[model samples]
Target: MEEVAVASDGRALTVGSQQLAHSLFANYPLTAAFLSFALAQTLKVLTTWYKERRWDAKRLLGSGGMPSSHSAAVSALAVAIGFHDGPGSSSFAIALVLACVVMYDAFGVRLHAGRQAEVLNQIVFELPAEHPLADTRPLREPLGHTPPQVAAGAALGLIMAYLMHVTTNLSS
Candidate 1:
């Protein structure tokens, strides 16, 4: 079978390797998700190292990092959809709405919940030592997005989308 080669940020791959170009194009959104998640994890690790001068394993699994990974993924998808489907298209509109809801939840509702959890955990810790199950550890809830965190995530997502467009010659 003949394959058409396309060059990306240094990588070369054959086009039309999949059932359809659309299927292959859909990878943009998926890549955005993975990139966001990895970036968030990396940020947490880097932040921990900066603060304590050590690589803390726990930071890798912790939430509420410098940039909100959740924001990055959603914003990336939204931006991709807008680019692919046209900003006025129904698909883009839906994605935009979903992104707004997700960001709001991360910054507003979920953040509050995490703070509440922290308070609850503190209270639990202060309980009398004689009580049943007194040895149980307090719950740690991580929440809230600092403005800088959200901005960083948004910038990351937008940059990724733009880079994909430029490198892939993707219309978006």
Candidate 2:
């Protein structure tokens, strides 16, 4: 979506398109990002239920799952930006770069952090009841995504963004 500018008369100005004019959700790129994130998180719940044979409602809002919501959201934003502004546009470039960084961190830095947390939690579990640091709360163990999770997220994002673009253009 094009940037909304401030009008001389103080009204918010937007470039007119069918999406901006008639749609309840006016911000196309942001909407795509948010929808992708929601879908990925919801899928996490389903995936957990399938694998564990028990429903896990908390997966709807938790990190580290079958598909990384962070990756999904960012990739969707990047794809939507590319669709709206053209791949060569600055907005698309920024979004693409942001997506790359987020996915990379999800697979590398955050994954390592989660692994370290698991190890630390094990160590803490072995400590004597009287040890000073033994009482610390266990660190979260699912702070990142595996490579397959990230890949799934990215794929989901692309599909979602494409769908959003198609719908918007068709409605135009």
Candidate 3:
């Protein structure tokens, strides 16, 4: 039940669909951000497999892994915004702030929480057999990225955004 509308540039866009959803994808910044996130998650899976010598499909949707997907997503968004809208634009400023917040949280609060979880998990393991909490499952670790991981993710995001911009220009 959707109608198609031709853009001024001759690109056909679906209308009366999700109302603005298609338009969002048509925006290069949004597309770059999403692609960066996908690539980061995919890299996480590959990194895990390489390190552990086992494939962990769950990593695709998991958080707190190396090269922080959160960092990658926000950084890519910021970079893309800077590219699409000039760096002096308010949109770019907002995106940069958001990216900084996300990266900080990944390296600060989340990292501390992960460490706390590890300690609690160790405590539970050392508990006496009669302790009721001893039977509880261990907490999920790797809830945040190290500084290096955040840096790597941010670098990846910036690179991907630039690459996307270049590729889109070439295609156009």
Choose the strongest candidate by TM-score: 2
Q: Return the lDDT, model 2, position 161.
A: 98
Residues 51-130 of candidate 3 have per-residue lDDT tens digits of 99999989999887777888888888899889888899999999999999999999999899999999999999999999
Candidate 1 matches the true fold with a TM-score of: 0.76
Clashes of 1: 0
lDDT of each: 0.73, 0.92, 0.88
In model 1, where do residues sit more than 4 Å from their true spots? 1-26, 170-172
| Candidate 1, lDDT over the whole model | 0.73
Residue-level error in angstroms, candidate 3, position 172 = 2.6
- lDDT tens string, model 1, 43-121? 8788878988998777666777667777787788788777666889887788789878877887788788888988888
* Best model number under lDDT: 2
Clashing pairs in 1: none
**Candidate 2: where are CA atoms >4 Å away?**
1-24
Tell how far residue 11 is off in model 3, in angstroms: 21
Q: Compared to the true structure, candidate 2 yields what TM-score?
A: 0.87
Q: Give per-residue CA lDDT, model 2, range 6-108, as digits (tens).
A: 6546998776565455453777999999999999999999999899999999999889989999999999999999999899998999999999999999999
